[model samples]
Target chain A: MSEGERFTLAEARDLAVKALVTAGTAEGNALSVATALVAAEADGQKGHGLSRLASYAGQVRTGKVKGAAEPQIERLSASAIRVDAGAGFAFPALDCARDALVSMARSQMIAVAAVYNSHHFGQGGYHVERLAEQGLVGLMLGNSPQAIAPWGGTQGLFGTNPIAMAAPRREAPPLVIDLSLAKVARGKVMAAAKTGQEIPEGWALDAEGRPTRDPEAALAGTMIPMGEAKGAALAMLVEILSATLVGANHGFEASSFFTAEGPPPGVGQLLLAFDPTPLSGGGFADRLEILVNALQSQPGARLPGTRRLTAREVAERDGLLVPAAIVAEIKALLR
Target chain B: MSEGERFTLAEARDLAVKALVTAGTAEGNALSVATALVAAEADGQKGHGLSRLASYAGQVRTGKVKGAAEPQIERLSASAIRVDAGAGFAFPALDCARDALVSMARSQMIAVAAVYNSHHFGQGGYHVERLAEQGLVGLMLGNSPQAIAPWGGTQGLFGTNPIAMAAPRREAPPLVIDLSLAKVARGKVMAAAKTGQEIPEGWALDAEGRPTRDPEAALAGTMIPMGEAKGAALAMLVEILSATLVGANHGFEASSFFTAEGPPPGVGQLLLAFDPTPLSGGGFADRLEILVNALQSQPGARLPGTRRLTAREVAERDGLLVPAAIVAEIKALLR
Candidate 1:
């Protein structure tokens, strides 16, 4: 925002696609990955948006992430699936997993799939929203690299460990809930470091287990577990699902891919989709519709995913906002 | 604990099981259901323990809940499933679901099972702990009858929804978290009312949305959500997965079995279990063991489920302290 203006959604995706393709991606993979990133920005999640292109490009330049590899799925059961991202980024892996889940859930009533060795998947809400659109309730849980410290400790031991859930409502936008177990996402710190700003206390601790506001100290030290032990416990839940259960890296084993990398981060995500219609006896859709109506009727109620839905609507109606700096960075990478 | 002293785990189970059987249950169902309740008390979750015997008895007496019904698998897929509890209580239904899921997970690696048209299942931790005992990572979610309002709403539209997760840990008891998504659970209200104590101001709103100190008045109104909207949103997530996704009652339709009766509450739960060895490889278990070591090393760090584990250890070591009156009340029900 400080070093750029805006571009419409089309222009942003177009530039991204072109840059990714120029970096040696297949046309289809490039387009989808690009669209996914731009969609993140349009949906108000600037953290996962075009800002990531530079890192992606850097990884591509170093052979850390392959752009052209297609994800492969080895189905474990009609309800369980595992996708190896072919050493590629997360978009392809997620797309494969999402498609497989939607199909499996129609008859299975539910499906669980894990994607491993994929790059950071942008805003998990997008995939769950897509699943909701397919008439399936979707829940996603993922583990990233180690981030915050355990409660009463001063060293990092877990990732932000995010969870996102989405359900379709009849004649209404999908209901979505996406959250980070960490009080503040590590991205906020990275953003602060980028902008040279200070953070509030209680969000993180210094190396000596003391609360601090200095972003630099916060980064060099450790983040406080959110909500004290509760957040810490939830993070452990995420680790079990996303790391230990999914056979991916756990805790400190998964390294950060931002500045450096050791083991491809081994991020693992669990995605679940269940057909709502069958579960509802033909009333599930109507019930959610009613639930949404009631939520909307509340004086200040905003149904989950409303803002993102509206944000997407506006982006479609007008144009997507692509910061000029991001565009410039993408352009430079392409050149 | 004023009117009654704690009973030995075995004695409590025996008394509760005898009462339930007298109400109509035949062997296996009675034992499984009784075990769940006794386990709750053993875990120190008195709210879900023998305290519900009276309601369970009333439900049986009125023919609202089946005491001698078998759970049927309504739908089954390799990694997905649905079970109909035959309009029975949830304890047996969940027991069956976990049994099925364990088999599915062994072959599928990950499996999800939902139970429909069932009464309260006592404590979710019991089932998840069982699954974890099988060396699988287990996550459980359950929704009860409506007792909570949406974040900013003044009316009850959600159950005191609970989400629980359990995982195998190294050198420590299984990590388990089971909590309702309300500032205070309904059990707390019941406890306060029984003790003739005033409820907290934000715990719930009295009839007509007035924050009241009277426990009875607050019970008549809606329970305030935990952390406001976050709690409400989380409750919504639980509803979608446990109810909507399971084809059972959601929200207000959930108002039966617990307080009123239109039909049995049809409580539903979604259980996810996966093998950690395959996902985390050889060192995964040891890595978590290290985490357990670190958690214990933290000053004042009592593991999340440690309280229950500690209580059980002490109770086992010192024997349960049962109040004479509680023993008499339980004996009366048994007779």
Candidate 2:
């Protein structure tokens, strides 16, 4: 952050929106995507931040993403909603889903929103945090293009599907826990290979489905799941909830999220919101404080997402630093 | 099946009911508890099956569990139902929840059931399967007495909380996935200790908060969570969902499920049911088939709950074998 060029949060968002709009994205959709990307960047999730703009803009220009597509929201039932992203950026669709779920959950006690034909929903925590901000407990699952294999199988049949959950607090920001099913992101292996380093043995499997430490071999094979087999099972559950239940393309069938050379990924996401007040008999917030106190009081025990919260505070005070090369590339999009 | 005394499934249920009734359980409650235990036995979950009868009967006899308490169900909101277990066995309350959630989910497309003042829920998957049987996707979470410590801490602050999910299929039994957050069950450690064997390194932390393979030391320590920190986080999520949200005792505050001397556990469980038809635009079953076929096609890949299904089939064909000691104990209770 100290070495790279810095931009205020507003400057970052405006820059991204301008670049995306120039590449044919609708203003509202671009703003939604920009906001999510900037939030991710501020939180130190650089992989999901402004680095994604070049590929996203490329997809829009190539018709792999309908930059101006309007997301359509449907109330399928009293406590169910379906948002069709129309092969557009995922943020706007998720925004629509969040808007619908907040009120629906207040009335129904619990509600679900499913979005299909969408692009990547960066920082899964972002969507759930919004729900938590409104005094609701939120859980979200989203399937991406495949990266990890089914446990014991050589083929990558499931996304490093992410699951995010958020619980509202009475006097603090919501507590958000976000994790991907994969042991580590694929980019780490790529970086290791570039530096001629051996990756961790359990990080990935070789082409023949044997454990390997060779980064090159690991890339050719599939990434190992977090917690081994249990993670694979969780990944499959996420796939079933986000993809199968949404009637969208499964992870294995989706196109790449990092490239725009193929068809739209057509991935899916599911968001569930619950009004904790009635469910917990009005004691949810106070009880949560008890658990939080216990967690924080323990020596060496850290609450999840504390690091992200710290990073966000730093970014808010001193602006976010972006690599000059990527900033240059994004600026070129405005031409 | 060949060595131990065998009993037909019906006989198993009847014996369990008689033993619990003799211990002063209400007839209706006894039947509910017996049904779940027998189902667990049939599914090869012995830890939750007949082996639990002695402890359960003891608790009932000692008045730690209210033997004649009836689960009282209240509709908390349009899509929320609360079943106070009345400090009774958990089965009857979960049964009330299942019945309420099935019809509620069918009407609202999604509904939640929260049960507090409950005892051990035997097998978490059993309740979810009941919902699946009624054409609903079911997810259940329950917090138990503490057996695991928070990550990076020495004290046991969370239970080996379990999460179970079941999705209904078209022409097959529901696909059910049930997992406890612990790396391995504490019983494994106890067995190793009895036989003077060493447990695996990551299975537990010694009383001094260091890794240990000696089963004796591990027994006095906390069980490691599955997936390390991620698993601990999930356990916390389950604790929040089941205990905090239900206004029931947290894992650390609850009594041991294995003993009859302490206060009632007063644990809690949460079940969520979703109607998949409308949510998936009536294509839910078909889309699930596609994923199932893909998974089964892989040679080494096994569906999550196939082993349980096979065990149930075998039990249905041939009677289940029960240890003579346990049979004697139950028979003595009845006498």
lDDT of each: 0.76, 0.89
Report the Cα lDDT for candidate 1: 0.76
Here the TM-score of candidate 2's chain B is 0.97
Question: lDDT, candidate 2, residue B246?
Answer: 81
Estimate how well candidate 1 is docked, as a DockQ score. Answer: 0.48
Runs with alpha carbons beyond 4 Å of true place in candidate 1 = A1-4, A22-28, A190-198, A222-227, A260-263, B1-7, B169-173, B194-202, B205-217, B256-263, B278-287, B290-300
lDDT of 1 at A64: 68
Model 2 chain A: weakest 10-residue lDDT segment is A1-10
| CA error at residue B76 for candidate 2, angstroms | 2.5
lDDT per residue, candidate 1, B192-230, as tens digits? 999999987878888676678899988888887754565
Interface RMSD of 1: 2.6
> Cα miss at A44, model 2 (Å)?
1.1
What are the per-residue Cα lDDT tens digits for candidate 1 across A1-335? 36566677878888888787777777777777888888888888888888887777666656667777888887776777788876678888898899999988897777777777766887988888899988789999988777766766766667777789988766767788987767677778867888999898777787777888988888888776544565676677777677666666666667666743454666788888878776655678776777677767767556777778788888788776566776678789778
Model 2 score (lDDT): 0.89
